[model samples]
Target: MQPILANELCKDLGSFSDNPQITGVITDSREAAPGTLFVCIKGERVDGHDFALAALQKGAAGILCQHDVEGVPQEKRILVKDPLDAMIQMGANYREHFSPLLLGVTGSVGKTTTKEFCYAVCSAFGSTLKTEGNQNNEIGVPKTLFRLDSTIRYGVVEMGMQALGEIEKLTLAVRPAGGIITWVGQSHLESLGTRENILKAKMEICDGMPDGAPLVINADNDLLSVAKVPQRLRRVTFAVHTDADVRAVGIQGDEKGTHFTICDKEFGSFPAFIPAMGEHNVADALSAYALATRLGLDPERAAQALANYSTTGHRQNVVQHCGVTVIEDCYNASPDSMKAALRTLADYPVCGRRIAVLGDMFELGEISQQAHESVGVMAAQAGVDWLLTVGEAAQDISRRASQLGVNAVHCSDKAEVLARLLSQVKAGDALLVKASHGMALETILEGFYKQFQNTTGVQDKIAGECKSWKNSRF
Candidate 1:
């Protein structure tokens, strides 16, 4: 981060200080260093004020705190009623000073991957900074803003929410120049209740957008396909299965990646490839391509850069383990993303059966069973041969698949599921492992890697190759 006067940080507190220059901002006190500004956060488990003195001892230049701590220089101390809000206000103040072209992204399923595609495409034009990992919440957005400087030309901020008004707060912090709404789905059904409410919440990304800012949306989603946008906001639609301003046509995929033709009304048509499979990923690429092109990036060059796009870990990572093809997509799951993974699994050409080992889909509230069963029906329709599941909610999936005459098993124990999979899985089969994040399905992937180490040396390769791309900083 560029150095800023300590007085500028305390501007929200109606105070000014000329004694210090803060070169960096951090939330954790342990990360404090010389020329660093520490913002004390009161988390559920730990309060950061207790560590403020520790941070000062580590050479912090200043501290933003709700309460005073002993041993801090009086000249650098800035008091605020709410430190989080003060941080957001400071970040917004900093953002307005630089005026970088910011692109805000919000969605149910593909926000991270879509943001990654935006990073890869926009980097072709100039320096770009994107939200790291799942840092799309109130705290995360401020951290992302803190990283912005004069060298950055483009900023991609991912916004996530579990209820209404959360995205509004984040957008107000970002005040983006452009926005993208990847397809809305029933991700947070527990709190938000329905897809309609989810759509309403996701649209809040534009609540803080500037006038005349282009708002890109997925035209293929059933909800977004008919949703209305504010008249003052420019809406750009991207689709793969419907007529829209931008589209991906002639889509083809394999275990390697997806190849498609990008059709834009203004840019004509061009071939593109993303180094990731699944049609859902194609939609993500289209949204990024549309945003990058609108920002004056060469359409062909932007499309070319997408070929190097890599998905973050556990989201459809294909690997060869123990001579078996494993699509380790167990990062997180929703009904929409589960169906997309099933389709990708079905599409992969395999000499043996296409097996799907699914776990529970969390946060569905009253519709959890129906949502899991819906994925079961989708798996059957997608031609899944063997369906193995864990968790009580996934029992519905196994039952539905069994009723559909597909080979299905609902295991009650992780050990039993592992033993069954180890006994039956062979070299030629293609397997997909997915579930909600709380299920910790990655443990199963690790167990598979350990159990297969005696048969093949592919475990080391999978670990080395499948590191999450979330750490990539543009």
Candidate 2:
């Protein structure tokens, strides 16, 4: 980050007496260095106010805190009502120095993939920076905005929220030139009550953009399909099953990648491919394509750039182990994403059978039971040869799937899940492991790699190939 005066950093947020030129912004006191401004944050477990003196002693140029520290002088501190809000203000202040063409992305699912797709598309036109991983909340947005500089011509920020008004604050601060709402699902139904509420919250990305700024959307989403947008903003649509301004056709996927044709009115049609599968991923790429084209980028360049898109951590990452296809999509899950993953699993080319290990989908509130059961029905509908479910909630999946004639097992824990799989899993079987981030289902794969080494003495050769799957890769 470019250095700014301590008073300048305070600009509209608070007051600062000293004029120390702050070189960088930091939250942790341990990272405090000369010319750096330490922003005190009062978290649930640790309070940054208690460490203000330590930061100052460590050569921090200034402090932005909610309360005054005993030893820190007034000249070196910027006082405010809340440090988190102040941090947002600091980010907005810092962002005032650059003029990058910023775009904001938010949704119940596919936000990260769409953001990465946008990154690939935008960077083809110029240098770009995007929110790394799932950093798309209050704290994450400011941190992402802080990365802006003169050299960056495109900036993609992913915004995530659990309730209403959260995305509003983020979009106001981001002030994106354009926005993308990938799809609205029941991800935060526990907090927001319904998909309608989720849609309301997701549309807040347009709260800060000026009139006519394009807001790209997935027209295939049932909730977003009928929902209304602000009349002043241009709604750009993309989908596979619905009539949209931008769409994907001739969609097909296999082990190597997915290939499709992008159909846009202004750009005509062009073949596009991503080194990943899933029609959902194709929808994500379409959204990125729509966003880039509406933001004055070349449509052909955006389509070509879509080929460079890759999956982020633990998001439907496919691996081949022991001559079996394994899909590790154990990041975060919702009923919608679970269904998508199951469809992808069903589509995998396998000689023997298709097996699925589905865990719990969190934050469904009163609909949790029905949601889990529906996933079980989806498993059966996907023609899964066997369904193994972990977690207490996933028992519903097993129960419902079993009622539908699918060979299903309900494991009490990961231990039981691994044992049951080890006895039956063999070459030519395709396996899918999916759950919410809290389930830590990745450990099940680790257990498989360990048990494989014990049962077979070819552990060395397997280790050379799987690398123990120690790093969540096989």
Candidate 3:
């Protein structure tokens, strides 16, 4: 963020006594330095206020705190009713220092992929900053803003929320030029209760847009297709199954990627292919295209940019290891993404068997059992040759698949899951590894390769890590 006088940024919070030169904002004291504003956020495990004195000791210009810290000088502390909100406000203020066509993306699934695609298309025009990985929450939103400067021409952020009003807060801070609500699902039903609530929360991305700004959405979604959007905003729609402002026709997918004809009512249609698997990905690519074109980029250039799209980290990223085709989508999961991965693997042309290694899908609340069972039904329907599941919640998947005549194996922990997979996996098989982030099922995928190298020590270390994860987080 550009440097500014502290008094200018915090005039409404309280007195600007002994105002400091604010160079940037930080939440971690370890990264604090001169002219840095350390925000004291009260978390469930660690309290940021506890690090206030440590931040000042490190030459932090000032600390934004909810209350007084014991050894910190009163003048060095910028008190507030809530430091997190104050930091968010600071981020919104900091955004005024730069001019960029900022865009926001949010949904129960696919927001991260959409964010990456948005960045790719936007960067074709100029330097663009995007949310790093899946950091789409409060802290991540403001931190992404702090990366802004005069050099960035476009900004794309994925806004995630657990309940109502969260995305509104983030969207307000982003003050998006335009935004996309990917598609609502059951990922955070634990907090928001119903899909109706989820759709409402996802639409909050519109709250930050200018009156005439475009708001893109998935017209294929039954809820969003007919749902009311703010009257002042221009609505843009993308889809594969339904009529939309922007749509894909004759969609086809191979193990390598997908091909589709881009049909648009506004910018004109063109042939497009995204080098990624699944119809969901095609939808993600189209959404990115619609959002970019709505922002006035050349339609064909935006369509061409989809060709450069690739999976990041555990998000549908394919790995060829030990002569096995591995789909390592361990980043996070909802019922929608889980089925998407399974269908991709099912459609995958394997020399021998198709195996799916699944872990628990988190945050489903009352629907957790039904969600896991539905994934199990999807696995059986997809003709998975073998099923290996980790964690107690995923056992539901095993039971449902086994009842449907699929060979399903449920393990108490990742260690057992790895052992079963190692015993059954052969050179000709394709493996799909998926789970929520906390379950850390990627370790099982990593451990499978280690066994091929005959590294028992590393294998044991992986097992121990899984045990620790099970004992702690799971």
Candidate 4:
């Protein structure tokens, strides 16, 4: 962000301060540049206040500090109750200078994919600036807002949260002109405790929306239907199952790609194609199509742009390992997403065996066991040939698979899983690796990739050191 005087920022935020013009805002002392304003944030591991002298020595023009520091000059410091709050105020201040249509997106799943789709569609309409690389949290959101400058005609921001009020802070910072709630699901249920609470937290994105701004919603989510969205705000609904303003029908996919039909209120039904899997993704495409249409992009052009949309890494991305097809969705998981992945697996034509390498879902709180077991039952019912589970909580999934007479293996660690999978998987098998981001299932995926390369005589094209056990030559 451009350097602004401390006095100017205080005026924009409506906060009282003696000195206003204090250069740039920075969170890390190491990144503090000359004539910049350093914000000393107390985070989980590091305390920024302790680095005040370091930042000043690095040429920070001013500091936003939570506590008084002895070495820093009093005139160059702006004391606030909370540094995070101060950062939020700065974002609000920065936002006043830009006149762009702010599009905000949130949901239990598909937020990132939907955000990408929105960026693609909006880019076709005007100059766009979007969230780069999962910068959707407390720190990331404010940082993203600061990146918005005068040239950006439209701003698409992805807002994520684990608890209540987080989205409210972000929405207030950007004051989005439009919003999209992808779908309500069982993610972050550990902290949120219940689906109802999750809905409330996601709906907080609308708390700071303008009175007449468009708030797009998924009519399929029962909780969202009952959300206390403001009466003054304009509401737009999209769905795949029920009749809505935007809908996807006749969806079809294979190992190669997916094809579907998009029906809109004004444009009628149009064929839309995406190089991705899962019906949920088709729904996400519909949301993007609707938003783009509302923003004045031609329906045909928006659908064409969506057809070019491809899945990002680790989110249902398909890879060929030797002769086997591997679906590497190891980025993250929840009960809803797990079920969706299994359904996709079920739809694929498997010549030999269909295997799922599952891991703990995490953050389900007291219901973790039940949630895992529920996914186990889903895998069994979906006709998975074998179920391999990792972590202590995932034992419930393995047990449920066994109870349903499905071949299930429970491993305490990656080594045990590799040993078992190496013995069972053959050339014609299709395997899916999925778990919460915390489980680090990508390590297990890398192991399988190495095995495939060795057995099938396929060299690793991606150059990097193998971080785990060496490839076991059979």
Alpha-carbon RMSD, candidate 1: 5.1
Off by over 4 Å in 2: 450-474
In terms of TM-score, the best-performing candidate is 3
Q: Which digits, one per residue and each the tens of the lDDT, describe model 4 over residues 210-308? A: 777777888887876656678888777888788788888777664356777888887888888777777877778888888777766799888988866
lDDT of 2: 0.86
- What TM value does model 3 have? 0.93
Cα error of candidate 1 at position 40, Å:
2.6
- Runs off by more than 4 Å, candidate 3: 453-474
- Return the clash pairs for model 2, or none: none
lDDT of 2 by residue, 195-232 (tens): 88899999988898889999888889898887788999
Look at candidate 4 and give me any clashing residue pairs: 5-20, 5-21, 5-22, 6-20, 6-21, 6-22, 7-20, 7-21, 24-37, 190-363
Candidate 3 lDDT over 1-474, as tens digits, reads: 778888776756765577777888888999999999888998989999999999999999888898889999888887899776786777777777787889999988999999888888888899989999877888888889989988899999889987799889999989999999888889889998999999989988888999999999999888888879899999999998889999998777544467778999987788887877778888999999998998899999898888878778888997766557788899999999998899888776666689999999999999999999999999999999999898889999999999999999898888988888777776656789999999988788778878854223223223222211111100
Residue 220 in candidate 3, Cα distance off native in Å? 1.0
Q: In candidate 1, which residue pairs clash?
A: none
Better of 2 and 4 by lDDT: 2
Q: Candidate 4's C-alpha lDDT?
A: 0.80
Indicate the TM-score of model 1.
0.90
Instruction: Report the C-alpha lDDT of model 1 over 1-474, residue by residue, as the tens digit.
Output: 788777775565755355477788888988999999888889999999899999989988888888778777667678888886787777776676687788899999999989999999888878999998888776788889989988899999998987898888888889988899998888898999889999999999888987778889999999998889888888899998899999998886543577889999989999998888778889999999998788677989999999868777787788877657789988889999999999888767665689999999998899998999998899899899998999989999999988998899999967777888888886667889999988988888888888854254344344334333332211
What's the candidate order when arranged by decreasing TM-score? 3, 2, 1, 4
Q: Candidate 4: misplaced stretches above 4 Å?
A: 10-24, 226-228, 454-474
Q: What range of 10 consecutive residues in model 1 has the weakest lDDT sum?
A: 465-474
